[model samples]
Target: MRAIKDEHRAARHRRRRLSLAVGIPVAMAAAAGLTYGTAFGVFGEDAQPRASAATAAGAAAGAASAADDVADGMADDVADGFASVNALGQNGTYGGRDGKTVTVKTLADLEKYATAADPYVIVVAATITMDPKGKEIKVASDKTIVGSGTSGQIVGGGFFLGQGVHNVILRNLTIRDSYAGTWNDKEHDFDAVQMDGAHHVWIDHNDLRHMADGLIDSRKDTTYLTVSWNKLSDNNKTFGIGWTENTTADITIHHNWLRETEQRNPSTDNVAHAHLYNNYLQDVAGTDITSSYGNYSRGNTKMVLENSYFEGLNNPVTKDSSAAVVQRGNVFVGTSGRNESGGTAFDPKSFYAYTLDKAADVPAKVKAGTGPRAATGVTAEAASSTLTVAKDGSGRYRTVQAAVDAVPANNSSRVVVSIAPGTYRETVKIPANKPHVTLQGTGGSRKDTVIVYDNAAGTPKPDGSGTYGTSGSATVAAEADDFQARNLTLSNDFDEKANQNLAGHQAVALRTAADKAFLDGVIVEGDQDTLLLDTAAKDKLGRAYIRDSYVVGNTDFIFGRATAVVDRSVITLKKRWDGTSQGYVTAPSTPADRKGFLITNTTVTGDVSARSFYLGRNWHAGGDATLDPQTTVRDSALSGAIRTTPWSDMGGFPWKDDRFAEYKNTGAGSGTASGDRPQLTDAQARNQEIADWLGNWNPTALNPA
Candidate 1:
């Protein structure tokens, strides 16, 4: 239905439908001489050849009513484009497990349809080979093997039989890696599928391209599942592991498609309960660990990876590295997580002369910072002690919304406004009674400083109906309430080649809506609506506190439905952060007692490390995207470039317990954990519920090591 393949505009609409079906029979013979020239004088006196036959039958019925109004305006422009296109097919169709109807095309006829008391399903469309020495796909327990895609592939090396498998599904199909190992790691054993401790399942789309262990392996309970769209590219050691702790729950993943990819295994394997969305990812930082660990977890766990996307990698995300955890966790990243900053942070001596000789210094100031520490040292002989700011200064405000419209709304006094570095375009908001507004950035090394802009959604506006998704578009919009900012950086530069499903270019580089906001060491890039933190419908208690922040963009770039707290933040990505990242990750415009978007000790990079990403999902919409599941994340750090059933479903319903969880995280995509991580014992993580949504927050003031 999304046919974007135009061969000369569909051959000029088939030669205008062969000139309107041969000009509607020669325009109905010139409409019978225009219906005998308007009925030729009512047939009076021989009526001149009967008035040319009534003007050729009234011009053939007015040329057939102007060709039926040009095919009824192309059938109402295809019924208004399928009524705003959203047929929303989101998978899932073969109910009846063992009522029987199998047709497996390979993998040993799907091992004669394994059965843990009758598990069944094998819907396919093509490619389904697999048999690297036979005996693998041995799934049992309630089963499902869906693939119904035209080009649905599933080449080779897929095996899942870790004993007594339970509810299952192997979806979509496209599991490559026909066994070509030998990186000397002892043949690498070849893999494109494997799920030993399988349980409730629901893999979707499926497309583990160039695999070598792209998707598989979940021990123990195996909990709820729901993988989303699929596509994993290239390969040289892919991943998505889990063992020991064994616990996989409400998993979700959206859109799909990934490139390059690396880190097949950094430390302990992982790919715990997830929910990743959007889709489309390029380069992916030329593989490798790419630093920024992928959606990590261990022991207790609950995951959520928002609208996805992450171009060139290099630590697009990170958290508990060197995997090793017992229990306790909860993870969340909404407003559609993003990535792609490279403005400067991979510090390779200025990127080896900016890539050897391109002289990468696109600088008027590539974020520098060493001039604000003297709002009081200006008296000693008027020395103002190293105070410098004036390329147009009052602490420089060339427009970040005129320093948030010169904050001072419903103030009780607390105006830090310092912004100095540069790149300050516009589009900022902080309304909600500007309580104690703060936006430090007079340079304290947030890599110098910046604040770009690039309005998205086609960037037209003025009622021209362009940028800002919900008809609003953005480029820095706040909603106030103890708002605070730090170090500094916020971009949008929207220009996806000119646009490519960024849902119509709705760009944004920060659009918060108040609560007790406080973004430190900030830096947000853009692709699609990057960084929106909307209180959408407001109050999940509403309060943010993104520490050591950093965000990039693609789609859903940091979504809304507030209640923030992305500590040690750095949730990056390159592309594939689908406006829905597909699977799902914080669509919670919130309601159910309000609670959504709460990334903890965050760090989730993406450059495709085996299993492409997805962390959060099932976010109802204002008035219910299925609220709460209380978005959460604790002591985070997940690598392995995720996407193995994270969590999705904004309205398809099926997410129980309703409160994504994760805890005691480790690295390399930490996979196992129980009771939804976050084992909270130390006085329930500092007076509970992450300090009541960051208001009187105190988690060691987020100075976590």
Candidate 2:
């Protein structure tokens, strides 16, 4: 019997490898262009492909038995992953399965049933768009929000699981298009789904995207949460975890397709046990958004990533200096930047039993199996014309700059340059002549596509023509009107530590100096003067809308002269290159008559020490006091890193003379109005709203209604 078992195991391995070799090309081809029907036929109905014939008759019989084992390994409706781990005396995440079933077609009906005390299975039966836009229906414990076949569509709003809520499930629904006019929506906390300190929840087989804020926000120590077989796309901040300092959250993320998103490809922060496997993260370049990173392990998180497929991501798998990440059996195609793993992560099998599909099969398997399954048949939208960029010869252009060069100098319509997942170490400049051009990332995740360079303000030109000034040191400079970048990273890895002797340390990751410019789901990083949001000229009116993106740096990081609104985004304040804790967040140099910068509905935080940083100091361009340098920080969360006196003087200019004020701000950094800390009154805040600054130009009109 032992001999027979050994023969069967060997036979199964050989057959699987053979099937992979023969079927992978077909799968890849199908993923590229085929419709849902054709893609589904390539794999048949089986979750795992059938094995080839064995050498002998006895071995053939054993191989047949092993095939049965493969079928049994696939997860079923009865909870799997971390949701299956019994905790708090509960068996698993059943989610009102045995409770009374109810059907709802309107917001009132859905809200009524969702907040009820009794357990109920709620079925959404129609396309219901929330009236108040971005409204979140508070859901109680022991509930299920499932779509009625393929008819259920929840638009412009979503559900909220509050603290201690448990035993809930959100499945088989299409929740999308909640985008308000402001990309950096600082006023609305809209999300497809959000849980605060919730547990025993499962989010599976749903399509979520284009929300005003995040697609999914699992914050405040949410544990016993399992996200599986879902499609998250067309947005910034796909999925986030852990807002609490305690590392108590346990999560399982698997078999999901995260595409066209910017960052937080499930950023697991301070998680005790984070088990991710068999997920497909594709960053489709040449779209409106690019991804920054995927599977980020932050704040002492212990993460285990396995058998996943990552395409065209900037940083596919990354961890903070204090985090532990263990990766295995993952396939990275066209990926670039940091694919790091360190420390021994916990064994996922000890907590729950789950099977992983082969990494090579993940893309096909996930695309075919995930998302809402219609009762009739699966369907997909047709592809649009796009210029492809891939370094591996799979795309039309070999380099990103080449694709940009191919675009018509003065194109009338939008020209999308889709970049495949890979590291592109070059500076990209979008000339002013090229308008309505989008630099998109076509990868499984945004982190799969990277556009990076290493040039500091002091770096000498190759032609020996002096230094590349702060304005010229940008990795990606967009000087065209209506320019957009999605789902990618623009990084200036200038090695500030290595070039400490250099006089000028400013390194610009991204500089946008055009009107109606937009950046979605992108990562712009450097050491000093990272994101420079300037106008076409000092007198030109340049309005840049940056949402669902990340800006990382220290001294005068987010400084510029443009009318910029950073909504629903994160401003990460890192220490100086020498590892010093002191720094400033912004150094606005706006013209006296125009608005400098509006950091609203955003979060200001990082790994820096408390009371070490200032909110901002006015920047008078060329010592010109005529510039008002106005900056309003409102309705945002500020970390303790900000000093008590968040404003300061600069270049012989008193910050009090400039326009710097805050309103309704929270966290340790926020304080009452004083001489140094200016606060906006309710009457004053009304004048400083997003609408007041963006007068006559509605940013929301750019997106689909």
Candidate 3:
């Protein structure tokens, strides 16, 4: 039997005892009411050994001195932070598939399909540069215009959704430098993408910038629309919804990165109900978002702001007396902004069945899924930017694996491998010799370029190992040093629903066992063990710089011994389809010396019920491993899926001995320190900075100019 420890060990037992004596009954009854199933161990007895009398008394004294009185507004803060809003509107069925396939390359070919009556999948083969500046192409109904490869652009022009235009899907295209004549010497006309009296439209994974007028304007009774994963930047007027009409406009703007723009990002005019969630707004000269300027004579507008991040902006939300704004789960950093409406605003809950999120955790959620990516080469010139992978043989290679195999061994300079907008179902790996390699996707965002595999930890491999271990089931594995990836999705679609009871169902989406790596605008999805940052070199170990990314999973999703810094990222815990008990988030097995996981300025979202998931636990593999797990989560937003007991024991390792701490965390899941969570002091938090953890390696220097 393992011997019981002292100091913090006794405190852990005390809290466990208190929780069992108090919180179990309530949680069990709540669980039953929620029909979440059993095996949650809410009332399980302590299986480990007990402490001595002296140790217990010392632990009690420590708890008394460390824990302060609970402040007021705790319940209100939880309510404000844990609310859920619909970003995709009432139903997930925004654009159902009922279209015929048709590929188009030039402007004439595109125009032919745009005016066609039947529903068509118009795939753009190359960049269509318009000689006539600001010429707008009118798109007809029932059209899906998707960029086929890296060369898809509408330079000096834009798209126009005229009257009666509906059910149009525009994705993975660039609309830039659109100058539709000049007015008052200010260059007026030309919206990057304009919609007039259109409905049921989906605009996703598109880059719209440098327009004379608004980047996008949906007005004149446009309803039932979803705009996601688009980057709007370097423009005067960003966007405006329901600008002209007093009619009810139902619009959802989520996962959009609005940067370096002026006002109207966007200004909501006569919108009936607008849901703005998980969006990143930065460096705006004017108003960020507004439900104000309302047609007060028409009716009151309702805007729900949830899980949004605002930085370097002023006057975030300005509401009219006739409009109502419910501000929840939003973060304002390094800027002066009004979160709540100054004038009369309607209740968001009254308009829809939704919950709120904590204002503090919004930054993490917003940056995780926002903006256009992998367009760095398209926007600027780079020597390393070359190579393309297209499924229809439009580019150099068709499969991502073939592109990796083509990389010369022991390459010195960085090589950018551009992937087209398509789903490649294959496992990919970068050998150790291939360094300074960048795998990029020309999809505007992660939703466009998808690389997937169906391998779980329980799945058998041809190798001697009976099953693919947790590390072996990854869809994309980068084993080389100085590896980088951006604007793409790596997913492991193992059927966890069918094999719920099977052991080792851990399906890893991305396994970065590299000495150094950087990930930006990336999406990694799986059910369990989604992201594995394994320690690579013995001297350097694994050091990763992950920013502006999204990771989704359930049990031990972000597990590894790597010293990783995850900044401005979104970590989402998806609820199991079978409705079983949700599992842990992080399982770090860091050694005694190294820094394990430092998740800062990130958002941790989930679909599970309140207080259902543990933040992290010390992973022991199989036996009592001497793994001193070190992790710190600060300045981030967490969903209600995290429980009050944020830290818990894993196997025989006591969580009290680990160096897991959080500071300045704002969200529903950020409970008081009296519970399982331990608050870090100012000095202790200073030791957890990126510079402090990474000795000489600077992540900011890695950014390509």
Evaluate all candidate structures by whole-model CA lDDT and list the values in order. Answer: 0.45, 0.76, 0.65
Q: For residues 1-705, could you state the per-residue lDDT of candidate 3 as single tens digits?
A: 111111121112212111112111333333322332212111111101111232233234423422321111100001111112233222222121233445576888888887788755576667787657777889887666666544577788778888767767676678888754432125557787788887767777678888778789887777666677678877767787775647467777766788777677777777877778777777734543322211111235677766777777766666766777777667677666454553343454454444334545545654553333333211221122354566754444567876676565787766667788999999999989888777777664466789999888888787756888778888999999888887777899999778767687888999999777877667788878889988775345788877767777788888888888877666777777577647888998777667788887666765567778888888865554666776788776666667787877888788877778888776667766653678776655655666555556654443331
Q: Which of the predicted structures, 1 or 3, would earn the higher TM-score when compared with the native? A: 3
lDDT at position 615, candidate 3: 84
* lDDT at position 132, candidate 2: 85
- Clashes within 3 Å, all models in order: 157, 44, 16
Scored against the true structure, residue 195 in model 1 reaches a CA lDDT of 60
| Alpha-carbon shift of residue 572 in model 1 (angstroms) | 23
Show where candidate 1 strays beyond 4 Å: 1-390, 393-417, 420-450, 455-498, 501-517, 520-529, 532-563, 566-654, 657-705
Error of 2 at 213 (Å): 67
Candidate 2 or 1, higher TM-score:
2
For all predicted structures, in order, the TM-scores are 0.19, 0.47, 0.46
- If ranked by lDDT, best first, what sequence of candidates would result? 2, 3, 1
In the range 1-705, model 2's lDDT, one tens digit per residue, is 010000111112212211112222323322321222111122321211211111122123333543443353221234568877789765677665444567798989999989999876687888998888888899999787788668889999998999999988888889998888666567778999999999889898899988988899999998999998899998877898988899999999999999988899989889999999999988877887777998899998999999999999879999999999999999998888999999989989899878878999999989987888664111110011255566654443557776666555676666666787899998889899888777777554446688999999999999999999999999999998888777777889898889978878899999998888777666678889999999999879999877656777889999999998877566777877677888888999988778778887666777777789898888998999788887888777677778898888899988877888888776667789777777777666656656556655555433211
